[model samples]
Target: MAPTLLSSPLQGFTDFRFRNAFQHYFGGIDTFYAPYIRLNGQLKIKQSYQNDLQLENNSTLNVIPQVMTNDPDEFLFVVKYVQSLGYKELNWNLGCPYPMVTKSGMGSGLICNPTRINEVLHKAHNESDIVVSMKMRMGYENATEILDAFPILDKYPLKNIAIHARIGKQLYNGPVDLDAFEKCISGTKHKLYYNGDITSLESFKKIQNRFPTIDHFMIGRGLIADPFLPNMIKNDTKAYPKNRWEIFSEFHDRIYQQYDEYLSGPTPIKMKMLGFWEFFSQSFPNPQKIVKAIKKASSPKKYQETVASILKNV
Candidate 1:
Protein backbone atom coordinates (compact mmCIF):
# COMPACT_ATOMS: atom_id res chain seq x y z
CA MET A 1 0.00 0.00 0.00
CA ALA A 2 1.65 3.21 -1.09
CA PRO A 3 0.44 5.66 1.54
CA THR A 4 0.61 9.06 -0.13
CA LEU A 5 2.51 10.87 2.63
CA LEU A 6 2.83 14.63 2.06
CA SER A 7 4.92 17.19 3.92
CA SER A 8 2.60 19.97 5.07
CA PRO A 9 3.87 23.49 4.46
CA LEU A 10 4.37 25.51 7.65
CA GLN A 11 5.13 29.16 6.91
CA GLY A 12 8.24 29.35 9.06
CA PHE A 13 9.12 25.69 9.40
CA THR A 14 8.93 23.77 6.13
CA ASP A 15 10.81 25.20 3.14
CA PHE A 16 12.95 23.99 0.26
CA ARG A 17 16.02 23.55 2.48
CA PHE A 18 14.15 21.79 5.28
CA ARG A 19 12.23 19.55 2.87
CA ASN A 20 15.40 18.72 0.91
CA ALA A 21 17.38 17.85 4.05
CA PHE A 22 14.56 15.78 5.49
CA GLN A 23 14.15 13.88 2.22
CA HIS A 24 17.88 13.15 2.15
CA TYR A 25 17.81 10.97 5.28
CA PHE A 26 14.15 10.00 5.51
CA GLY A 27 12.28 9.76 2.19
CA GLY A 28 8.56 9.13 2.68
CA ILE A 29 6.88 12.38 1.68
CA ASP A 30 5.72 12.11 -1.94
CA THR A 31 4.96 15.74 -2.70
CA PHE A 32 5.57 19.04 -0.88
CA TYR A 33 3.76 22.37 -1.16
CA ALA A 34 5.78 25.53 -0.93
CA PRO A 35 4.53 28.06 1.61
CA TYR A 36 1.89 30.38 0.16
CA ILE A 37 3.11 33.45 -1.73
CA ARG A 38 1.11 36.68 -1.44
CA LEU A 39 0.85 38.39 -4.84
CA ASN A 40 0.22 41.86 -3.30
CA GLY A 41 -2.22 42.56 -6.17
CA GLN A 42 0.72 44.15 -8.02
CA LEU A 43 1.55 41.18 -10.26
CA LYS A 44 5.08 41.35 -8.78
CA ILE A 45 7.01 38.98 -6.51
CA LYS A 46 9.27 40.27 -3.75
CA GLN A 47 12.98 39.42 -3.70
CA SER A 48 12.57 37.23 -0.62
CA TYR A 49 9.47 35.60 -2.06
CA GLN A 50 11.28 35.06 -5.36
CA ASN A 51 14.09 33.37 -3.46
CA ASP A 52 11.50 31.07 -1.92
CA LEU A 53 10.10 30.09 -5.34
CA GLN A 54 13.38 29.78 -7.30
CA LEU A 55 13.64 26.46 -9.19
CA GLU A 56 17.41 26.27 -8.61
CA ASN A 57 16.90 26.39 -4.82
CA ASN A 58 14.62 23.32 -4.99
CA SER A 59 15.93 20.99 -7.74
CA THR A 60 16.21 18.17 -5.24
CA LEU A 61 12.61 18.59 -4.06
CA ASN A 62 9.29 18.21 -5.91
CA VAL A 63 7.21 21.21 -4.89
CA ILE A 64 3.85 22.63 -5.92
CA PRO A 65 3.76 26.37 -5.58
CA GLN A 66 0.96 28.11 -3.59
CA VAL A 67 -0.48 31.59 -3.98
CA MET A 68 -2.51 33.50 -1.38
CA THR A 69 -4.51 36.15 -3.19
CA ASN A 70 -8.16 37.10 -3.53
CA ASP A 71 -7.77 39.15 -6.67
CA PRO A 72 -8.25 37.02 -9.77
CA ASP A 73 -5.63 38.90 -11.75
CA GLU A 74 -3.02 38.63 -8.99
CA PHE A 75 -3.83 34.97 -8.53
CA LEU A 76 -3.57 34.22 -12.24
CA PHE A 77 -0.30 36.14 -12.48
CA VAL A 78 1.29 34.13 -9.66
CA VAL A 79 0.04 30.85 -11.11
CA LYS A 80 1.39 31.74 -14.56
CA TYR A 81 4.78 32.62 -13.06
CA VAL A 82 5.00 29.23 -11.31
CA GLN A 83 4.01 27.59 -14.60
CA SER A 84 6.95 29.47 -16.10
CA LEU A 85 9.08 27.66 -13.47
CA GLY A 86 7.68 24.42 -14.97
CA TYR A 87 5.31 23.70 -12.07
CA LYS A 88 2.17 21.95 -13.28
CA GLU A 89 0.14 22.43 -10.11
CA LEU A 90 -0.89 25.56 -8.17
CA ASN A 91 -2.60 25.57 -4.76
CA TRP A 92 -4.84 28.39 -3.62
CA ASN A 93 -4.59 29.34 0.06
CA LEU A 94 -7.89 30.08 1.76
CA GLY A 95 -6.58 28.53 4.95
CA CYS A 96 -4.40 31.32 6.37
CA PRO A 97 -5.99 32.84 9.54
CA TYR A 98 -3.92 35.86 10.41
CA PRO A 99 -5.98 38.96 11.24
CA MET A 100 -3.62 41.05 9.15
CA VAL A 101 -4.35 38.89 6.15
CA THR A 102 -8.07 38.40 6.80
CA LYS A 103 -8.85 42.03 7.57
CA SER A 104 -7.34 42.90 4.22
CA GLY A 105 -9.91 40.72 2.40
CA MET A 106 -7.76 37.54 1.92
CA GLY A 107 -7.21 34.17 3.58
CA SER A 108 -10.09 32.88 5.72
CA GLY A 109 -11.81 36.23 5.51
CA LEU A 110 -12.31 35.47 1.86
CA ILE A 111 -14.49 32.57 2.96
CA CYS A 112 -17.08 35.10 4.08
CA ASN A 113 -17.81 35.68 0.41
CA PRO A 114 -18.41 32.71 -1.90
CA THR A 115 -19.06 34.84 -4.97
CA ARG A 116 -15.46 36.00 -4.72
CA ILE A 117 -14.18 32.40 -4.55
CA ASN A 118 -16.38 31.40 -7.45
CA GLU A 119 -15.10 34.29 -9.49
CA VAL A 120 -11.47 33.51 -8.74
CA LEU A 121 -11.80 29.78 -9.45
CA HIS A 122 -13.69 30.50 -12.65
CA LYS A 123 -10.99 32.94 -13.67
CA ALA A 124 -8.09 30.60 -12.77
CA HIS A 125 -9.62 27.61 -14.52
CA ASN A 126 -10.39 29.62 -17.60
CA GLU A 127 -7.06 31.45 -17.72
CA SER A 128 -4.36 29.03 -16.52
CA ASP A 129 -3.84 25.82 -18.50
CA ILE A 130 -2.45 24.17 -15.35
CA VAL A 131 -3.74 22.01 -12.53
CA VAL A 132 -5.19 24.00 -9.61
CA SER A 133 -5.84 22.91 -6.02
CA MET A 134 -7.13 24.49 -2.81
CA LYS A 135 -6.34 24.38 0.90
CA MET A 136 -9.00 25.72 3.27
CA ARG A 137 -10.38 25.79 6.78
CA MET A 138 -13.94 24.78 7.74
CA GLY A 139 -14.91 28.42 7.94
CA TYR A 140 -13.65 31.95 8.31
CA GLU A 141 -14.81 32.55 11.90
CA ASN A 142 -17.09 29.54 12.46
CA ALA A 143 -17.41 25.87 11.52
CA THR A 144 -20.55 26.37 9.43
CA GLU A 145 -18.86 28.88 7.15
CA ILE A 146 -17.79 26.21 4.73
CA LEU A 147 -21.36 25.03 4.36
CA ASP A 148 -22.32 28.12 2.44
CA ALA A 149 -19.26 27.91 0.21
CA PHE A 150 -19.30 24.15 -0.52
CA PRO A 151 -21.50 24.37 -3.61
CA ILE A 152 -19.24 26.96 -5.20
CA LEU A 153 -16.10 24.95 -4.43
CA ASP A 154 -17.69 21.77 -5.76
CA LYS A 155 -18.33 23.58 -9.00
CA TYR A 156 -14.59 24.09 -9.64
CA PRO A 157 -12.22 21.65 -11.32
CA LEU A 158 -10.17 21.16 -8.17
CA LYS A 159 -7.44 18.51 -8.19
CA ASN A 160 -7.90 18.20 -4.41
CA ILE A 161 -9.46 19.96 -1.44
CA ALA A 162 -7.41 19.93 1.76
CA ILE A 163 -9.44 20.90 4.82
CA HIS A 164 -7.99 21.91 8.19
CA ALA A 165 -11.38 21.06 9.85
CA ARG A 166 -11.58 24.19 11.96
CA ILE A 167 -12.55 27.85 11.72
CA GLY A 168 -10.08 30.62 10.97
CA LYS A 169 -10.48 31.92 14.50
CA GLN A 170 -9.51 28.53 15.97
CA LEU A 171 -5.95 29.04 14.69
CA TYR A 172 -4.41 25.63 15.53
CA ASN A 173 -6.25 25.43 18.86
CA GLY A 174 -8.54 22.62 20.07
CA PRO A 175 -9.05 19.25 18.41
CA VAL A 176 -9.93 19.03 14.70
CA ASP A 177 -13.64 18.50 14.29
CA LEU A 178 -13.81 15.18 12.50
CA ASP A 179 -17.55 15.80 12.43
CA ALA A 180 -16.79 18.72 10.16
CA PHE A 181 -14.51 16.60 8.03
CA GLU A 182 -17.49 14.29 7.70
CA LYS A 183 -19.38 17.35 6.58
CA CYS A 184 -16.77 17.92 3.89
CA ILE A 185 -17.26 14.34 2.71
CA SER A 186 -20.99 14.90 2.66
CA GLY A 187 -20.92 18.35 1.13
CA THR A 188 -18.47 18.21 -1.73
CA LYS A 189 -17.67 15.84 -4.58
CA HIS A 190 -14.06 17.03 -4.63
CA LYS A 191 -11.43 14.47 -3.53
CA LEU A 192 -10.76 15.19 0.16
CA TYR A 193 -7.39 15.40 1.95
CA TYR A 194 -6.84 15.77 5.71
CA ASN A 195 -4.54 18.39 7.32
CA GLY A 196 -4.71 19.07 11.05
CA ASP A 197 -3.32 17.90 14.42
CA ILE A 198 -1.69 14.71 13.04
CA THR A 199 1.33 14.54 15.38
CA SER A 200 1.93 11.15 17.01
CA LEU A 201 1.63 7.61 15.70
CA GLU A 202 -1.40 6.94 17.90
CA SER A 203 -3.33 9.93 16.54
CA PHE A 204 -2.49 8.90 13.01
CA LYS A 205 -3.80 5.39 13.66
CA LYS A 206 -7.20 6.79 14.57
CA ILE A 207 -7.25 8.68 11.28
CA GLN A 208 -6.09 5.69 9.26
CA ASN A 209 -8.71 3.42 10.83
CA ARG A 210 -11.44 6.01 10.37
CA PHE A 211 -10.57 6.98 6.82
CA PRO A 212 -8.99 3.74 5.63
CA THR A 213 -9.05 4.87 2.04
CA ILE A 214 -7.45 8.28 2.51
CA ASP A 215 -4.10 8.51 0.67
CA HIS A 216 -2.92 12.03 1.51
CA PHE A 217 -2.16 13.61 4.91
CA MET A 218 -0.37 16.88 5.66
CA ILE A 219 1.89 17.27 8.73
CA GLY A 220 3.55 20.45 10.00
CA ARG A 221 4.73 21.22 13.58
CA GLY A 222 4.63 17.50 14.37
CA LEU A 223 7.32 16.70 11.80
CA ILE A 224 9.56 19.49 13.08
CA ALA A 225 9.21 18.22 16.67
CA ASP A 226 10.00 14.74 15.41
CA PRO A 227 11.78 14.52 12.08
CA PHE A 228 11.23 10.77 12.05
CA LEU A 229 7.46 11.27 12.03
CA PRO A 230 6.97 10.52 8.32
CA ASN A 231 9.28 7.53 8.56
CA MET A 232 7.41 6.25 11.60
CA ILE A 233 4.11 6.58 9.77
CA LYS A 234 5.44 4.96 6.59
CA ASN A 235 6.70 1.92 8.48
CA ASP A 236 4.18 2.06 11.33
CA THR A 237 7.19 1.81 13.67
CA LYS A 238 7.93 3.53 16.94
CA ALA A 239 11.04 5.69 17.39
CA TYR A 240 12.99 4.57 20.44
CA PRO A 241 15.50 7.30 21.17
CA LYS A 242 18.06 5.40 23.27
CA ASN A 243 21.02 7.10 21.64
CA ARG A 244 18.85 10.17 21.91
CA TRP A 245 21.59 12.74 22.07
CA GLU A 246 23.48 11.16 19.19
CA ILE A 247 20.39 11.33 17.03
CA PHE A 248 19.85 14.91 18.03
CA SER A 249 23.47 15.78 17.27
CA GLU A 250 23.33 14.21 13.84
CA PHE A 251 20.09 15.92 12.82
CA HIS A 252 21.24 19.28 14.19
CA ASP A 253 24.59 19.04 12.48
CA ARG A 254 23.09 18.22 9.11
CA ILE A 255 20.48 20.99 9.31
CA TYR A 256 23.12 23.50 10.43
CA GLN A 257 25.64 22.55 7.77
CA GLN A 258 23.03 23.07 5.09
CA TYR A 259 21.88 26.31 6.68
CA ASP A 260 25.40 27.71 7.05
CA GLU A 261 26.19 27.01 3.43
CA TYR A 262 23.02 28.74 2.29
CA LEU A 263 22.61 31.49 4.91
CA SER A 264 24.95 34.45 5.25
CA GLY A 265 25.99 34.79 8.93
CA PRO A 266 25.33 34.06 12.59
CA THR A 267 22.05 36.05 12.81
CA PRO A 268 20.36 34.03 10.06
CA ILE A 269 21.58 30.76 11.55
CA LYS A 270 20.37 31.86 14.98
CA MET A 271 16.96 32.75 13.54
CA LYS A 272 16.45 29.35 11.92
CA MET A 273 17.48 27.38 15.03
CA LEU A 274 15.47 29.62 17.30
CA GLY A 275 12.37 29.17 15.18
CA PHE A 276 12.96 25.43 15.10
CA TRP A 277 12.93 25.01 18.88
CA GLU A 278 9.34 26.26 19.00
CA PHE A 279 8.40 22.78 17.86
CA PHE A 280 11.64 20.89 18.61
CA SER A 281 11.27 21.57 22.35
CA GLN A 282 8.25 19.26 22.43
CA SER A 283 10.41 16.12 22.14
CA PHE A 284 13.46 17.42 24.03
CA PRO A 285 14.08 16.59 27.70
CA ASN A 286 13.64 19.44 30.20
CA PRO A 287 12.44 21.49 27.28
CA GLN A 288 11.63 24.69 29.16
CA LYS A 289 15.16 25.15 30.50
CA ILE A 290 16.81 24.00 27.27
CA VAL A 291 14.74 26.39 25.20
CA LYS A 292 15.53 29.19 27.63
CA ALA A 293 19.23 28.53 27.32
CA ILE A 294 18.90 28.33 23.58
CA LYS A 295 17.01 31.59 23.49
CA LYS A 296 19.65 33.23 25.68
CA ALA A 297 22.54 31.97 23.57
CA SER A 298 24.62 34.95 22.39
CA SER A 299 26.80 33.25 19.82
CA PRO A 300 26.63 30.35 17.37
CA LYS A 301 29.24 28.50 19.43
CA LYS A 302 27.16 29.07 22.54
CA TYR A 303 24.07 27.76 20.77
CA GLN A 304 25.87 24.61 19.63
CA GLU A 305 27.35 23.98 23.08
CA THR A 306 23.97 24.56 24.74
CA VAL A 307 22.34 21.95 22.49
CA ALA A 308 25.15 19.53 23.28
CA SER A 309 24.79 20.08 27.03
CA ILE A 310 21.04 19.50 26.97
CA LEU A 311 21.33 16.26 25.04
CA LYS A 312 24.17 14.94 27.24
CA ASN A 313 22.01 15.58 30.30
CA VAL A 314 19.27 13.46 28.78
Candidate 2:
Protein backbone atom coordinates (compact mmCIF):
# COMPACT_ATOMS: atom_id res chain seq x y z
CA MET A 1 0.00 0.00 0.00
CA ALA A 2 1.16 3.56 -0.58
CA PRO A 3 2.17 5.28 2.64
CA THR A 4 -0.01 8.03 4.08
CA LEU A 5 1.73 11.39 4.45
CA LEU A 6 0.51 14.08 6.86
CA SER A 7 1.72 17.61 7.50
CA SER A 8 2.35 17.96 11.21
CA PRO A 9 1.15 21.03 13.03
CA LEU A 10 3.72 23.50 14.31
CA GLN A 11 2.00 26.03 16.58
CA GLY A 12 3.46 29.32 15.36
CA PHE A 13 4.17 28.30 11.77
CA THR A 14 1.47 26.10 10.27
CA ASP A 15 -1.31 28.67 10.18
CA PHE A 16 -3.92 28.58 7.42
CA ARG A 17 -1.93 31.00 5.26
CA PHE A 18 1.11 28.74 5.27
CA ARG A 19 -0.99 25.65 4.66
CA ASN A 20 -2.72 27.26 1.72
CA ALA A 21 0.54 28.47 0.20
CA PHE A 22 2.21 25.08 0.71
CA GLN A 23 -0.67 23.23 -0.96
CA HIS A 24 -0.46 25.64 -3.89
CA TYR A 25 3.30 25.16 -4.35
CA PHE A 26 3.84 21.56 -3.37
CA GLY A 27 2.26 18.12 -3.32
CA GLY A 28 2.34 14.78 -1.37
CA ILE A 29 0.67 15.59 1.92
CA ASP A 30 -2.53 13.58 2.25
CA THR A 31 -3.77 15.59 5.23
CA PHE A 32 -2.81 18.82 6.97
CA TYR A 33 -3.20 18.93 10.76
CA ALA A 34 -3.88 22.49 11.84
CA PRO A 35 -2.19 23.93 14.89
CA TYR A 36 -4.05 23.14 18.12
CA ILE A 37 -7.07 25.24 19.08
CA ARG A 38 -6.29 26.05 22.68
CA LEU A 39 -9.20 26.37 25.12
CA ASN A 40 -8.46 28.24 28.29
CA GLY A 41 -10.44 27.94 31.52
CA GLN A 42 -13.14 30.16 30.03
CA LEU A 43 -14.20 27.37 27.62
CA LYS A 44 -14.22 29.93 24.81
CA ILE A 45 -12.57 29.22 21.48
CA LYS A 46 -10.58 32.22 20.30
CA GLN A 47 -11.82 33.96 17.15
CA SER A 48 -8.49 33.22 15.52
CA TYR A 49 -8.98 29.55 16.24
CA GLN A 50 -12.52 29.66 14.90
CA ASN A 51 -11.31 31.51 11.82
CA ASP A 52 -8.53 29.00 11.27
CA LEU A 53 -10.92 26.08 11.24
CA GLN A 54 -13.66 27.80 9.25
CA LEU A 55 -14.69 25.67 6.28
CA GLU A 56 -14.44 28.65 3.91
CA ASN A 57 -10.87 29.43 4.93
CA ASN A 58 -9.78 25.80 4.33
CA SER A 59 -11.74 24.90 1.23
CA THR A 60 -8.69 23.89 -0.79
CA LEU A 61 -7.24 21.16 1.39
CA ASN A 62 -8.16 18.25 3.68
CA VAL A 63 -7.60 19.52 7.23
CA ILE A 64 -8.08 18.10 10.73
CA PRO A 65 -8.36 20.52 13.60
CA GLN A 66 -6.31 19.63 16.70
CA VAL A 67 -7.33 20.68 20.23
CA MET A 68 -5.09 21.03 23.29
CA THR A 69 -6.63 20.53 26.69
CA ASN A 70 -6.58 18.18 29.65
CA ASP A 71 -10.15 18.91 30.58
CA PRO A 72 -12.98 16.69 29.38
CA ASP A 73 -15.35 19.66 29.14
CA GLU A 74 -12.96 21.55 26.94
CA PHE A 75 -12.45 18.49 24.74
CA LEU A 76 -16.20 18.06 24.33
CA PHE A 77 -16.60 21.74 23.57
CA VAL A 78 -14.01 21.40 20.82
CA VAL A 79 -15.79 18.29 19.56
CA LYS A 80 -19.14 20.04 19.17
CA TYR A 81 -17.58 23.21 17.80
CA VAL A 82 -15.51 21.46 15.13
CA GLN A 83 -18.33 19.11 14.22
CA SER A 84 -20.54 22.16 13.79
CA LEU A 85 -17.92 23.35 11.28
CA GLY A 86 -18.63 20.08 9.39
CA TYR A 87 -15.51 18.24 10.48
CA LYS A 88 -15.88 14.58 11.39
CA GLU A 89 -12.50 14.02 13.05
CA LEU A 90 -10.57 15.89 15.76
CA ASN A 91 -6.97 15.40 16.94
CA TRP A 92 -6.08 15.64 20.62
CA ASN A 93 -2.70 17.22 21.24
CA LEU A 94 -0.83 15.17 23.80
CA GLY A 95 2.58 15.86 22.21
CA CYS A 96 3.47 19.47 22.81
CA PRO A 97 6.59 19.73 25.00
CA TYR A 98 6.83 23.47 25.50
CA PRO A 99 7.29 24.44 29.13
CA MET A 100 4.27 26.71 29.29
CA VAL A 101 1.94 23.97 28.01
CA THR A 102 3.53 21.08 29.87
CA LYS A 103 3.80 22.87 33.21
CA SER A 104 0.04 23.11 33.33
CA GLY A 105 -0.37 19.30 33.34
CA MET A 106 -1.66 19.37 29.80
CA GLY A 107 -0.06 18.10 26.57
CA SER A 108 2.64 15.46 27.09
CA GLY A 109 2.70 16.19 30.79
CA LEU A 110 -0.73 14.60 31.13
CA ILE A 111 0.45 11.28 29.73
CA CYS A 112 1.85 10.24 33.07
CA ASN A 113 -1.56 10.46 34.66
CA PRO A 114 -3.45 7.51 33.28
CA THR A 115 -6.47 8.28 35.42
CA ARG A 116 -6.85 11.67 33.89
CA ILE A 117 -6.34 10.30 30.40
CA ASN A 118 -9.04 7.72 31.04
CA GLU A 119 -11.43 10.32 32.37
CA VAL A 120 -10.98 12.59 29.41
CA LEU A 121 -11.25 9.74 26.91
CA HIS A 122 -14.29 8.22 28.55
CA LYS A 123 -16.14 11.50 28.70
CA ALA A 124 -15.29 12.45 25.13
CA HIS A 125 -16.19 9.12 23.58
CA ASN A 126 -19.34 8.68 25.64
CA GLU A 127 -20.66 12.18 25.09
CA SER A 128 -19.77 13.04 21.51
CA ASP A 129 -20.10 11.71 18.00
CA ILE A 130 -16.67 13.07 17.01
CA VAL A 131 -14.03 10.56 16.01
CA VAL A 132 -10.98 11.30 18.13
CA SER A 133 -7.29 10.78 17.35
CA MET A 134 -4.20 11.72 19.33
CA LYS A 135 -0.77 13.22 18.67
CA MET A 136 1.64 12.46 21.50
CA ARG A 137 5.15 12.00 22.83
CA MET A 138 6.33 8.84 24.65
CA GLY A 139 6.06 10.56 27.99
CA TYR A 140 6.60 13.86 29.69
CA GLU A 141 9.56 13.15 31.99
CA ASN A 142 10.51 9.59 31.05
CA ALA A 143 10.25 7.52 27.91
CA THR A 144 8.12 4.89 29.64
CA GLU A 145 5.35 7.16 30.81
CA ILE A 146 3.03 6.13 28.02
CA LEU A 147 2.97 2.53 29.21
CA ASP A 148 0.32 3.18 31.80
CA ALA A 149 -1.91 5.10 29.42
CA PHE A 150 -1.83 2.58 26.56
CA PRO A 151 -4.40 0.25 28.10
CA ILE A 152 -6.71 3.15 28.75
CA LEU A 153 -6.36 4.38 25.19
CA ASP A 154 -7.09 0.91 23.87
CA LYS A 155 -10.51 1.02 25.51
CA TYR A 156 -11.63 3.68 23.03
CA PRO A 157 -11.96 3.61 19.27
CA LEU A 158 -9.44 6.26 18.30
CA LYS A 159 -9.12 7.31 14.71
CA ASN A 160 -5.33 6.89 15.06
CA ILE A 161 -2.37 7.73 17.29
CA ALA A 162 0.64 9.62 15.96
CA ILE A 163 3.63 9.32 18.25
CA HIS A 164 6.67 11.58 18.20
CA ALA A 165 9.27 9.19 19.64
CA ARG A 166 10.90 11.33 22.27
CA ILE A 167 10.07 12.10 25.87
CA GLY A 168 8.60 15.54 26.39
CA LYS A 169 11.64 16.65 28.37
CA GLN A 170 13.85 16.41 25.28
CA LEU A 171 11.78 19.06 23.52
CA TYR A 172 12.91 18.21 19.93
CA ASN A 173 16.61 18.39 20.81
CA GLY A 174 17.64 14.75 21.28
CA PRO A 175 17.66 11.67 19.12
CA VAL A 176 14.30 9.94 18.60
CA ASP A 177 14.12 6.67 20.49
CA LEU A 178 13.31 4.04 17.92
CA ASP A 179 13.44 1.34 20.59
CA ALA A 180 10.86 3.20 22.62
CA PHE A 181 8.71 3.58 19.53
CA GLU A 182 8.99 -0.13 18.85
CA LYS A 183 7.84 -0.73 22.37
CA CYS A 184 4.88 1.53 21.67
CA ILE A 185 3.85 -0.63 18.68
CA SER A 186 3.80 -3.66 20.94
CA GLY A 187 1.94 -1.86 23.66
CA THR A 188 -1.08 -0.71 21.72
CA LYS A 189 -3.46 -2.04 19.08
CA HIS A 190 -4.60 1.30 17.69
CA LYS A 191 -3.57 2.54 14.23
CA LEU A 192 -0.17 4.17 14.55
CA TYR A 193 1.59 7.05 12.80
CA TYR A 194 5.19 8.13 13.27
CA ASN A 195 6.27 11.74 13.81
CA GLY A 196 9.86 12.61 14.56
CA ASP A 197 13.20 13.51 12.89
CA ILE A 198 12.23 12.39 9.38
CA THR A 199 14.35 15.17 7.81
CA SER A 200 15.55 13.39 4.69
CA LEU A 201 14.56 10.68 2.24
CA GLU A 202 17.27 8.43 3.64
CA SER A 203 16.02 8.84 7.21
CA PHE A 204 12.49 8.15 6.05
CA LYS A 205 13.65 4.99 4.28
CA LYS A 206 15.43 3.83 7.39
CA ILE A 207 12.35 4.32 9.49
CA GLN A 208 10.24 2.49 6.92
CA ASN A 209 12.64 -0.41 6.94
CA ARG A 210 12.53 -0.56 10.71
CA PHE A 211 8.76 -0.33 11.01
CA PRO A 212 7.48 -2.01 7.90
CA THR A 213 3.93 -2.40 9.14
CA ILE A 214 3.41 1.32 9.87
CA ASP A 215 2.34 3.39 6.86
CA HIS A 216 1.27 6.80 8.16
CA PHE A 217 3.77 9.58 8.93
CA MET A 218 3.52 13.15 10.16
CA ILE A 219 6.32 15.48 9.05
CA GLY A 220 6.80 18.66 11.11
CA ARG A 221 10.15 20.49 11.07
CA GLY A 222 11.32 18.38 8.17
CA LEU A 223 8.57 19.71 5.91
CA ILE A 224 9.26 23.27 7.07
CA ALA A 225 12.99 22.80 6.50
CA ASP A 226 12.42 21.58 2.97
CA PRO A 227 9.04 22.28 1.43
CA PHE A 228 9.85 19.85 -1.37
CA LEU A 229 10.53 17.00 1.03
CA PRO A 230 7.04 15.47 0.85
CA ASN A 231 7.09 15.41 -2.94
CA MET A 232 10.55 13.87 -2.91
CA ILE A 233 9.53 11.24 -0.42
CA LYS A 234 6.30 10.40 -2.18
CA ASN A 235 7.85 10.09 -5.62
CA ASP A 236 11.21 8.72 -4.46
CA THR A 237 12.86 11.37 -6.63
CA LYS A 238 15.94 13.45 -5.96
CA ALA A 239 15.51 15.75 -8.94
CA TYR A 240 14.31 19.26 -8.21
CA PRO A 241 11.19 20.71 -9.82
CA LYS A 242 12.05 22.45 -13.10
CA ASN A 243 11.13 25.85 -11.72
CA ARG A 244 11.84 25.06 -8.11
CA TRP A 245 13.16 28.50 -7.22
CA GLU A 246 10.33 30.26 -9.00
CA ILE A 247 7.71 28.20 -7.23
CA PHE A 248 9.46 28.60 -3.88
CA SER A 249 9.75 32.36 -4.40
CA GLU A 250 6.06 32.61 -5.10
CA PHE A 251 5.25 30.61 -1.99
CA HIS A 252 7.47 32.80 0.19
CA ASP A 253 6.07 35.97 -1.33
CA ARG A 254 2.48 34.96 -0.71
CA ILE A 255 3.21 34.26 2.92
CA TYR A 256 5.10 37.53 3.26
CA GLN A 257 2.41 39.61 1.59
CA GLN A 258 -0.35 38.04 3.65
CA TYR A 259 1.47 38.68 6.87
CA ASP A 260 2.32 42.22 5.81
CA GLU A 261 -1.30 43.00 5.04
CA TYR A 262 -2.58 41.50 8.29
CA LEU A 263 0.08 42.70 10.69
CA SER A 264 0.32 46.39 11.59
CA GLY A 265 4.02 46.94 12.36
CA PRO A 266 7.22 46.40 10.43
CA THR A 267 8.86 44.57 13.31
CA PRO A 268 6.04 42.00 13.60
CA ILE A 269 6.22 41.11 9.93
CA LYS A 270 10.02 41.06 9.92
CA MET A 271 10.10 38.88 13.02
CA LYS A 272 7.53 36.45 11.60
CA MET A 273 9.48 36.03 8.37
CA LEU A 274 12.67 35.66 10.34
CA GLY A 275 11.07 32.86 12.32
CA PHE A 276 10.21 31.04 9.08
CA TRP A 277 13.71 31.63 7.76
CA GLU A 278 15.13 29.73 10.73
CA PHE A 279 13.87 26.52 9.10
CA PHE A 280 13.74 27.72 5.49
CA SER A 281 17.39 28.79 5.43
CA GLN A 282 18.48 25.15 5.67
CA SER A 283 17.22 24.41 2.16
CA PHE A 284 19.72 26.78 0.53
CA PRO A 285 23.50 26.72 0.24
CA ASN A 286 25.44 28.44 3.04
CA PRO A 287 22.43 28.31 5.34
CA GLN A 288 24.29 29.99 8.18
CA LYS A 289 25.07 33.01 6.02
CA ILE A 290 21.55 33.11 4.64
CA VAL A 291 20.08 33.04 8.15
CA LYS A 292 22.53 35.71 9.26
CA ALA A 293 21.49 37.99 6.43
CA ILE A 294 17.83 37.47 7.25
CA LYS A 295 18.49 38.13 10.92
CA LYS A 296 20.34 41.37 10.26
CA ALA A 297 17.33 42.94 8.53
CA SER A 298 15.88 45.49 10.98
CA SER A 299 13.22 46.85 8.63
CA PRO A 300 10.85 45.27 6.12
CA LYS A 301 12.68 46.76 3.11
CA LYS A 302 15.99 45.41 4.34
CA TYR A 303 14.40 42.02 4.84
CA GLN A 304 13.03 42.00 1.31
CA GLU A 305 16.39 43.12 -0.11
CA THR A 306 18.20 40.39 1.79
CA VAL A 307 15.74 37.79 0.50
CA ALA A 308 16.04 39.11 -3.06
CA SER A 309 19.82 39.01 -2.82
CA ILE A 310 19.69 35.38 -1.67
CA LEU A 311 17.23 34.50 -4.42
CA LYS A 312 19.40 36.20 -7.03
CA ASN A 313 22.45 34.28 -5.83
CA VAL A 314 20.48 31.02 -5.83
- Highest-scoring model, TM-score: 2
Kindly list the per-residue Cα lDDT of model 2 for residues 1-314, writing each as its tens digit.
66789999998899888999899899789999999999768878899888788998899999999999999898899899999999999999999898999999899999998898888889999998889999999999898998789999999999999999999999879799999999999999998999999988999999999999899999999998899999899998788898988888999999999889978899889889988999999898888998899989888889889998898899
* 9-95 per-residue lDDT for model 1 (tens digits): 888667777777778766668888889888655778877667777899888888988889899888888878888888899998898
lDDT of 2: 0.91
TM-score of each: 0.94, 0.98
In model 1, what is the error at residue 280, expressed in angstroms? 1.0
Candidate 1: what lDDT? 0.82
List the RMSD of every prediction in angstroms: 1.8, 1.0
State, as a TM-score between 0 and 1, how close model 2 is to the true structure: 0.98
Model 2: how far residue 47 lies from native, Å: 1.3
